[model samples]
Target: MRYFICALFFVVSAAHAQNTTALPEGAASPKATLKDISWMQGHWSGEAFGGITEEIWGPPSGGSMMFSFKLVSDGQVGFYELGHIRELDNTLVYELKHFHGDLKGWEEKDEVQSFKLVKVDGKRVYFEGFTFEKVSNDEINIYAQIGDEDGSAEEVTFNFKKE
Candidate 1:
């Protein structure tokens, strides 16, 4: 989300470093385990940063969940993004690219921001420095945290409801 884009880019690279231990051996990968998160499909909307933000996710398919986000304020678009949660190396990775209101890509044509999966519970997931908590079948909260070298971190949350 635009609200965290700047800080997210700077801090996410350290997510893996701070969370070094991998999942227990032989554990189910997120792709295989996240079938439960199918509830995340459909359109969800919320308010933040004095704007309306919407997220639309496609059902999991081919070991991936694809999504798009749009931010609108005062009847004008702020930004947009495309993202995917993909299974890779027995793990799940959240990767995304940003765009301007007119659809101009932010990163180079082939580059994206990547955050590795950390954990997944019944209705919550932890990825890198990010957390996603499902409040209900129609409500969810997501946020990304930025950590410092001293192991301290600051996070901001985004709340949404199925729409």
Candidate 2:
């Protein structure tokens, strides 16, 4: 029984890591711009983590595209995110801050979680540990590798339909 459990855990962990990846140490981000991801502009909603998720992205402007996200579970707001993809040093970087339902921040006032651009393949934009895949004019998928305080990580997919 112990060996069975261990094998199961390993298989699950490997599957979770397959959808996203972190940038290699000392590797520079790939060159990209807000225009490269302009197709993400618009309002989108989806279900994930057993909840309803919504995101709204503003069109690219002034070298950046701002966005907001929220998750609702059991009809109550669970959390929120505010972020932007911006041009920096000839590359693009995704940065965001998380907040509680009441608007309390999860990170320090001056800190944000950031993902550097990794690649811009056709119909997909791969950021460090995150990916945006456009499925159609009205459908999209976002894959994210979320890490816990204990150093474990899991991949989450959010499938969104334009609204």
Candidate 3:
């Protein structure tokens, strides 16, 4: 029993150490634009959380790239998200809002969750707690640190293939 508990502790710790990262305190956002992440444009699909996830990204336009996401589990609608990465003050910011299957928003009408840019490496764009990695022309991975009502956070990776 002692060995089992110790191994479980390490497993949980390692899970939390997966691909996402948070910005340092007082750090400034690096300059970026929709053009820098235009590679994200396309229809992508993947499996996550015991479900099928789909995302469609529109091409860069008017300083932003819009996207829509949906999750289907057990052949039923799970949730939806609408968002965009837009140029803000010559930098970039990612914003999104969640909705239920009935179109009821999870956030207040005037509220939007936002992530500030951290840096744009060769094939990866790192935001506050989210990162987008391009593996190839048809493959990409998005890592995000998601929080729960209990105030605990976990990193999730969504590996997508372009359709």
Candidate 4:
């Protein structure tokens, strides 16, 4: 009975060690460039459309930043948005996923938008010639003008701030 118990303990311990060793290499370390997105790493709570909206952002799996937005009103889920930002080919890129209330799962809606960070007055960053507007450090104002060939379209702005 003692010999059987000892062998069982050894087998269990060896299995546990093998499972722990399956963790990916470099998973415990973060990259240097990820520091640029440190400003957005937190939980932000706000109100939108008379409902409460909470956004959570964190360092991504591989040196990027993950962003998720959840909105609830009267304890009901309204909508959710998920996205990620990363630097690719010397340009800042953003990919967003959207889901309606009736959708089964999140769907990729927009194309991967790449922007060239143009410094305006050493404080503002502007990325022109895109469907989506610019993102700045001070204020969260997305200015977008769509459905115009002559560039005289309506400006749709969604504003947010640090919380």
How far off is residue 107 in model 4, in Å? 4.0
Report the lDDT of model 1 for residue 11.
Answer: 58
Clashing pairs for model 4 are: none
| Candidate 1 error regions (>4 Å) | 1-8, 12-32, 146-153
Residue pairs in steric clash, candidate 3? Answer: none
Instruction: Give the TM-score (vs. native) of candidate 4.
Output: 0.50
Question: Using Cα atoms with residue i matched to residue i, what is each candidate's TM-score against the true structure?
Answer: 0.77, 0.88, 0.88, 0.50
State the lDDT of candidate 3 residue by residue for 16-96, as single tens digits.
746666566798898888878999999999998788999999999988999998989889878888999999998999998
The TM-score of candidate 2 is 0.88
Ranking by lDDT: 2, 3, 1, 4
Could you give candidate 1's per-residue lDDT for residues 67-156 as a string of tens digits?
999989999888888998877776777788888889988788888888767677767777766667788988988875645544455565
- Model 4: lowest-lDDT 10 consecutive positions: 1-10
Error of 3 at 119 (Å): 0.7
lDDT of 4 by residue, 114-135 (tens): 3333222222223332222224
Model 1 deviation from the true structure expressed as Cα RMSD, one decimal place: 5.0
Could you tell me the lDDT of residue 92 within candidate 3? 95
Off by over 4 Å in 3: 1-15
